[model samples]
Target: MATTSLVPSSADDPLAYRPIALVDLLDRVLGTGVVVTGDITISIADVDLVYLSLRALISSVGALTPPEPPGGAG
Candidate 1:
């Protein structure tokens, strides 16, 4: 069996394809933040038996920090 990749191979497009490490990818995602949402449903005989909804926000702690008050430091 053969699998297909969505990303273009480096051999096919060296300039356009640059593989990123998993750690680097995660770092970028966390720095910028991301929202993920999904829904799942299971049905039997056209009747819905189970349903699931999920939502999540991922970001680094520094990215979530609130700005300082409008005043000089104490």
Candidate 2:
């Protein structure tokens, strides 16, 4: 069976994209991580989604670290 996209194709479609923060985006999803070369032809689109999600997770985790105070700064 052939399935057609529901998206109404238009020039504005490209402009409707979004850039979400790495941590806020990754919180809901579950996974480790994976990297690949650009030349690879497999599931390139989904890869971007995961990559962005991972970045957000890392960023959020980084912000959670406690900073040391002066003197001992522990």
Best by TM-score: 1
* Cα-based lDDT at residue 40, candidate 2: 25
lDDT of 1 at 60: 90
TM-score of each: 0.60, 0.20
Per-residue lDDT tens digits for candidate 1, residues 42-65, read 999999999999999999988888
Q: Show the colliding residue pairs in model 2.
A: 22-56, 23-56, 69-73
| Candidate closest to the true structure, highest lDDT | 1
lDDT of each: 0.89, 0.49
Clashing pairs in 1: none
Which tens-of-lDDT digit does each residue in 1-74 have in candidate 2?
Answer: 99977654556486554667887556533333333334323456566423222222323443556666778844
User: What value does the lDDT take at residue 15 in candidate 1?
Assistant: 84
